[model samples]
Target: MTDRNLRHPSPSPDATTSIAAEAEGFLLAQEHRSAAHREAQTLCDALPWLTTAQAEDLTRYYVAHRLRLSRQLFEASLARAEELRREYEARYLRLRRDLLRRHGAWASVLLACAAGVSGALSTLAR
Candidate 1:
């Protein structure tokens, strides 16, 4: 008869410890608390038949997926920020133009009044 130990070998303690350590590191590095919790749950739900290596592989897959999502979010936020910057710049230019127009109109009225006063004074002296 074939020996059962040879047919099915359990993972070594060191291997289990290494897998656990790597999983813990991955969880800690996660930025979102809820996403990390979900990943932890996924790991816990892994089948008992899975070997340490398989579990580690699954964990790595989850980490990679999370990283991809984070990159997408970062890109979206950057795009939104750039759009807001452009909008603010456009608004500032419009406000500046409005203020300059009003100031120019006021200055023209004041100059006209001053000229009228000077002409009347000269006519009275002659």
Candidate 2:
């Protein structure tokens, strides 16, 4: 069976994580409720001849389809965001390694110069 673990698992169940999750859930619920009402209103405006019962049934199906489309779009966006993050992070690591290597070489050169200066000064003093 394929492993189901998240590539970047959520942070440990801390208070901040719990609170953020709750807030996001609340916002999504509110958005869904508002969207459903607005969609039903548009449908009613367009099809004024629909009977109340028929309108209600149609609204339900419309809302279901809208939800499915929303889910697909959200998943696609999330995947793209993850891909971008991975690319950016890899580039950052490569750049950081190059910087450290350059800095190390400069530091070694500076240390050698300093040591030579110290030896010459001591010999002159003697």
Candidate 3:
């Protein structure tokens, strides 16, 4: 291989997956946009009295509003997901610490019991 090829290498599987995900997201966004436009058109259709320009303007405004709301919802969901991740991780750490402490206490008790048993046996032998 050439030096440039060696340095760059090929895309990893993860990179490919990321690309696929991006494409999928793009397609979904496009579909959502079309759906929003159709909805706006349907609303405009209900009002037959509007001029063509007025209808077009109303549709544009409606689509923009829908897009803004969708963006806000998506961002809020991402924030909530981040919060849940942090909460779960903290709870997991707390539970793990408690489990380790419990196990340590049990081990200490078992060690003391064995020592006591050996001491009694020695005393009896003497």
Candidate 4:
């Protein structure tokens, strides 16, 4: 086949302007997304009952549902983020509990040592 046909494969002419316009639209959409995410984070933080997963899912739902993009990838990404957030939260809570336990144990040991030293000094004075 000819080089032109080989390169493009399809007979459609290159739509540079159209591609650029679409790219511009995508950038605008991304900016809107960032703003929306910031708003969602604020709302989520204020409303402690709402999990991050729920906020993200709401964001994705609003974007996909309102924008009407047929792209399945965004929905999939939201679901994945929800799952990852759950796992991360579980690990964080476990780590926090472990750290607190260790801290309390160490504090008790220090207190006991202090008391023992004070008792010995008092006896020496007598």
Tell me model 4's lDDT, rounded to 2 decimals: 0.78
- State the TM-score for model 3: 0.81
What ranges in model 2 sit over 4 Å off?
Answer: 1-16, 122-126
Residue 11's lDDT in candidate 3: 93
- Of the two candidates 2 and 3, the one with more favorable lDDT, higher being better, is 3
Residue 30 displacement (Å), model 4: 10
- lDDT tens digits, residues 1-126, model 2? 235455645567796789998999789967986797698779877998999989888888888888788789889999999999999999999999999999999999999999999999999999
Q: Rank the candidates by TM-score, best first.
A: 3, 2, 1, 4
Candidate 2 residue-wise lDDT at 28? 98
- Measured against the true structure, the TM-scores of the candidates, in listed sequence, are 0.58, 0.75, 0.81, 0.46
| RMSD of each predicted structure | 20.6, 8.7, 2.7, 21.7
Predicted candidate 3 versus true structure: per-residue lDDT over 10-42, tens digit per residue:
899999999999999899889879989999999
Clashing pairs in 4: none
Task: Give the number of the best model, judged by TM-score.
Answer: 3
Candidate 4 lDDT over 15-121, as tens digits, reads 76778778997997787667666765676678777677887887677655544452455678889999999999999999999999999999999999999999999
lDDT for predicted candidate 2 compared with the true structure:
0.87
Alpha-carbon local distance difference test for all models: 0.80, 0.87, 0.95, 0.78
Displacement of the residue 13 alpha carbon in candidate 3, Å: 3.5
Query: What is the Cα-based TM-score of model 2?
Result: 0.75
